[model samples]
Target: MIELQGVHKAFGPKRVLNGIDLTVPTGESMVIIGGSGTGKSVLIKCILGLIRHDAGQILLDGEDVTKAERDAFLARFGMLFQGGALFDSLTVWQNVAFRLLRGSLKRPKDEAREIAIEKLRRVGLKPDVADLFPAELSGGMQKRVGLARAIAAEPEIIFFDEPTTGLDPIMSGVINDLIREIVVEMGATAMTITHDMTSVRAIADKVAMLHDGVIQWTGPVSQLDESGDPYLDQFIHGRAEGPIEAVR
Candidate 1:
């Protein structure tokens, strides 16, 4: 459903993505693992056209993403940001129904609220929580709210950025399981960028390791342990030694 070929991106003297090539088949989950500053977020931005690549091609279902109409293109995607990124001023249902309340996906306010409540339930939150502000919710609740919002629009593609960041192990596991289940049930193509190996193990059908601005290794999750690539080895095992140099 998505493909990148020889993609390149840089800011002044620093090059973040260099010759990146990846393919995400339709209705499958692809998780990208990499060290901090390795261009994982940049790669996603390039694909979404939030950041334009310097060279090469980004294709979404065989159509060039750069040339596509912005609103129409973005409407097909849903994203759960690294930070919960909820609107502090909006009530839970308002935040979840945000996209549905405006733009091309707009629905009647009452209908949007109903969909938001349903999505919230799907993410394990109850209806009573909908009228509360984000500040009233705990971190786990906030993250669940974000997940509800991501799937509320029923997007064809979903991107998860560090889905488990800041959650306790138990909550992280819950989110991982929820993400896997939602992707499967919705039949949405997913691309996630995260440092959490536990999330990778739970949510990925395929895994790609990004290093030095390129994909160093990519294969089925079942083969992850035996991939034998030094970069993948060091990153996955959290080894301080190996090909990756730990910053002091």
Candidate 2:
């Protein structure tokens, strides 16, 4: 459960998020769509407190968590980064179980390894792959490992950052299906940010389009095609000639 009200942020003279207001229900899957440099990622950072908002209210589960004890609050979340961002030194299992193996939450090594392998299987990875390092796997395999890592702690909320990016069409489809399954099977509240249309169709129950630093459209995924916002139309159809301005 998350809510943002009139959130505003800027970098020097360039305003990023003008006034972002959005919400995600306790167990809902909400995906945000937008072109690059539209402040989609910045919105996410604000929600997570990775970036400070100038003045606004961000409520997590009806509580004001914007300035709360951050780590205690953030422990409730898991995130799959766009680049996979795995450590080169740690094996796949360690990467998945990183938080579990260190600090006060540390579990027995054997127990952590077992949970890591189980999560890997849930993401359609073979058991033996757990022993390999990130560089040893292909890009698709790396993404699967990243998903496994994201869900390893079984956090109540999961944020997926471009889960289907940089892969071939088939691999992207595979990752999309895995994300959908995780959201449904775990009943985890999901917030995904991506530009991939296929990822939108597969992983989103509700869609919100971010443009010019605000949510221009938010609707059920089924109605996305017929929303009639020229910007949304241009984005989902991948058209070069519509209401969206080209980078020329």
Candidate 3:
């Protein structure tokens, strides 16, 4: 449901993305794997129109996103940022229902809270936790709350940035499974960028490896091990010696 053709972005003298061509089909989870400073986050920001591309086109459902109405276009998607990004001032339910209580998607406070509570349940959070503030929760709980908020609006598309970044192995696994389940249950197109191989294995239907601002490999997750690409080999195995330079 999303496509990028010859996408290029540069910041001053540095070229961050160079002709990135990628696609995420409807109802599929596409995970992007790359080392730090390889432009993975920049690629997603380009697609989301947060960082406008210098050239090329980004199409969402066959229409150019650049020309679409900003608010209406953004409403079709949800995002879970790298750090869980919950509001310190808002309670759990209020944070989850942030979008629902504002803008074109606004609903009555009671209705929004009810939906928020239901989504929290979906992400394995109890209703009792809804009244607590973000600071009152553990890192994993905060991540779950972030996931609940992402799906609270029932978006057609979702973007997850480094979903398993700071969690322990067990909590990472939990979050990964929750992401996979929610994406499938909602049947929403998903694009995730993460360096965590375990998260990729658990959450990706398709995988794409980015290197030097370009896609080095793109295929089904099942093919990742046998893809025979040097870059993919180095990344998935965490090998220090490969075609990909460790020095960046």
Q: Highest lDDT among the candidates is held by which one? A: 1
What TM-score does each of the candidates earn? 0.98, 0.97, 0.98
| lDDT tens digits by residue: candidate 3, 1-248 | 99999999999989989999998999999999999999999998988899999999999989999999999999999999888999999999999999999999999999999999999999998999999999999999999999999999999999999988889999999999999999999999999999999999999999999988888899999999999998899999999899988874
Error of 1 at 44 (Å): 1.0
Q: Estimate every model's Cα lDDT from 0 to 1.
A: 0.96, 0.92, 0.94
In model 3, where is the ten-residue run with the lowest total lDDT? 239-248
* Backbone N/Cα/C clashes per model: 0, 0, 0
Q: What would the per-residue lDDT of candidate 2 be over residues 1-248, giving only the tens digit for each residue?
A: 89999999999998899999999998999999999988888888888888999878899988888657777787788989898999999999999999789865689999999999999999999899999999999999998999999999898999988888889999999999999998999999999999998899999999999998889999999999999899999999898998889787
Error of 3 at 133 (Å): 1.3
Error of 2 at 26 (Å): 1.1
From the highest TM-score down, the ranking of the candidates is 1, 3, 2
Q: Could you give candidate 1's per-residue lDDT for residues 1-248 as a string of tens digits? A: 99999999999999999899999999999999999999999999889888889999999999999889999999999999888899999999999999999999999999999999999999999999999999999999999999999999999999999999999999999999999999999999999999999999999999999999989999999999999998999999999999999997
lDDT of 1 at 234: 91
After TM-score superposition, the amount by which residue 47's alpha carbon in candidate 2 deviates from its true location, in angstroms, is: 1.2
